[model samples]
Target: MGAVESRLAELGIQIPEVVPPVAAYVPAVIDGDHVYTAGQLPMVSGALPATGKVGDGHGLVPPADAKEYARISALNALAAAKSVLGSLDRVTRIVKVVGFVASDPSFTGQPGVINGASEVLGEIFGDAGVHARSAVGVSVLPLDAPVEVELILAFV
Candidate 1:
């Protein structure tokens, strides 16, 4: 296995199949040396694991759960990148990450939620996973998913 794949195995993670797009766009596209992925939802077995705005309230998806969803979304984004690049080992750096959180009005923990994605990438890629990032709070997301993530990767 490639270095990146080995790391994933060490972390007990198996890169999942690229998520099929919900709309017209492709999952990922290559332009020059970078691979850009469509925003990915936290899908398991082709279904969202949870759906709701994230907040502290009882009816909202808790911040912790949303964080886990962010991780799953990041994995989906990685799958998209791999589909285009044919291997994650070609990734020289994680260039950028943009995370969207479906959030309640009172929620201000978007950054923490996105950390789930960042942390996992770091574990897999070490220093190469560090990147510029944006954590946005949106009132809603496609499929009402609690979190969504997209990635930009620089590859050989």
Candidate 2:
């Protein structure tokens, strides 16, 4: 197994297969020594694990389900990054993570919501997981997923 795969096994994570793009853009792109991943929604087996905005009146269950879905989205983003680098160990730095939180107008916990993704990165990559990040509340997301996350990676 590759570094990412090995680490995931140790950490009990599985880098899911690349989720097919919803539109014209590719799942990821490489520039020089960097890899940029498109926004990844919460997909399991090519289907959304959860869909809906966060905050009041969202989802038949509590919003926690959707929050977990957001975290899952980040895991998928890492999977895409590793696919490009061949090994997560090749990642020298996590440049930035931009997390978009689909939310009700009254919702304001984007940072906490995105923490679901950030925390996973920290656990899987340890110190290398640390990176600049932005969590923004948006009116909606692609396919109305509760959240979407994309990553930028600089490899050694």
Candidate 3:
């Protein structure tokens, strides 16, 4: 296995197959020395684990669960990046991460939720995972997924 894959295995993290695009875009594309991934949802075996806006109140997905979803979405993004590069070892650094949270109007914890993704990347890649990021709260997301993540990676 590649060093990145070995690292993921050591952490007991299995990168799933890249989530198929719901629309017209490809899962990832290579540009110069970087690979950019499309937004990824927390899909498992072709289905979303949960759905709804995130908040602490009734009828909303909890921020903690949403955080886990963001982590899964990041894994999906990594799968796409590896698919494009043919191996995760090609990735030298994570460049940027952009996460969107489908949120209840009162929820303002987008950064904490996106930390799920960031933390996982840190566990897998150490300092190479540190990157610029943005976490946004939105009214809704496609498929009502609670969180979505995308990534940019610099590769050899």
Candidate 4:
């Protein structure tokens, strides 16, 4: 297996098949040495795991659950990015990761939740996985998935 896939396997993480485009945009775009991914929802197999908003009017899932979902979303983002870039070794660095969590006002640990993705990348890529990131709380996401993530990668 490839380094990227192997590493993920060692971590008990499997990169799922690339999710088809939800709309007009491609899953990822590789330009020069950088690759950017479209928003990735917390999809398992084919469907979203959860949905709703932060604060009021969306409380099907708790904030704590939302945080966990955010991490899952980030992993899926990496999967999407790898599908386009081919190999994580070719990844010079993870430039940035923007994670959006569908959360409740009482839930403010979005950054901590998205750490699931960050930790996975770090485990697989070491320093190369070190990245700039933003974790945000949003009202809702497409499919109402609890989380979504997009990645920016610099390739070798």
Candidate 5:
């Protein structure tokens, strides 16, 4: 296995299959030395684990749960990147991450939720995972998924 794949195995993570796009765009595209992934929802075996606005209230997805979803979304993004690059080992750096949280009006913990993605990337890639990021709160996401994530990677 490549270094990146070994790291994932150490973390007990198996990179999943690239998620099929919900619309017209491809899951990822390569331009020059960078790979840009489409927004990835927290899908497991082609289904969302949870769906709702994130907050502390009845019928809403909890922030903690949303955090987990963000992690899943990041993994999906990685899968997308891998599909295009043929391997994660070529990745030299995680250039950027953009995460979106379907949130309640009173919820303002978007950054904490996105930390799920950030932390996992750090664990998998060490210093190479450190990167610029944006955490945004939105009224809703495609399929009402609690969180979505996209990635930009610089590679050989």
Candidate 6:
């Protein structure tokens, strides 16, 4: 395994196959030295493990579970990046991350939820994973997924 893949293995993570895009867009595209990934949902075995808005409100997914979904989404984003770059080791730095949380109207924990994705990137890439980020709260997402993550990676 390449250095980045090895690190992921050490963390007990196995990058799944890149989720096929639901629309006309590609999963990732490389422009110059950066690879940009499409928004990735937390898909496992070709399905979303959880779906719904996240918040303390009734019928909403809990914040903790949403956080986990964020991590899974990040993993999928990593897979998409690897698919384009051939190996995660090709990445020189994580440039930016944008996370969207399907949230209850009253929910305001978007940053905390996005931290789940950031934490995993930090674990896999250390300081190189640190990057500019935006955590957004939205009423819904494609496939009703609780979280979605997209990444921009700078590579050699």
In order, candidate lDDTs are 0.95, 0.82, 0.95, 0.77, 0.95, 0.94
Alpha-carbon runs more than 4 Å astray in model 4? 54-59
How well does candidate 3 match the true structure, expressed as C-alpha RMSD?
Answer: 0.7
**Total clashes in model 2, counting residue pairs 3 or more apart in sequence or in different chains:** 0
User: Which whole-number lDDT from 0 to 100 does residue 10 have in model 4?
Assistant: 82
lDDT of candidate 5 vs native? 0.95
**Model 6, position 103: C-alpha lDDT score:** 92
Give me the runs in candidate 5 sitting further than 4 Å from their true place. none
lDDT per residue, candidate 4, 38-83, as tens digits? 8888777888766676443444676656666666676777777788
Candidate 2 RMSD computed on C-alpha atoms after optimal superposition onto the true structure:
1.8
User: Where in model 3 is the C-alpha error above 4 Å?
Assistant: none
Worst 10-residue lDDT window for candidate 3 reads: 1-10
- Candidate 3 matches the true fold with a TM-score of 0.98
Collision pairs in model 5: none
Superposition-based RMSD of candidate 1 using all C-alpha atoms, in angstroms: 0.5
Worst 10 residues of 2 by lDDT: 58-67
How displaced is residue 119 in candidate 4, in Å?
Answer: 1.5
- CA RMSD for every model? 0.5, 1.8, 0.7, 2.4, 0.5, 0.8
Clashes of each: 0, 0, 0, 4, 0, 0
TM-score of each: 0.99, 0.91, 0.98, 0.86, 0.99, 0.97
Candidate 2 Cα misplacement greater than 4 A, ranges: 1-3, 58-63
Model 2's TM-score against the true structure: 0.91
**lDDT of model number 6:** 0.94
lDDT of 3 by residue, 1-156 (tens): 788989988999998998888999999999999999999999999999999999999899999999999999999999999899999999999999999999999999999999999999999999999999999999999999999999999999
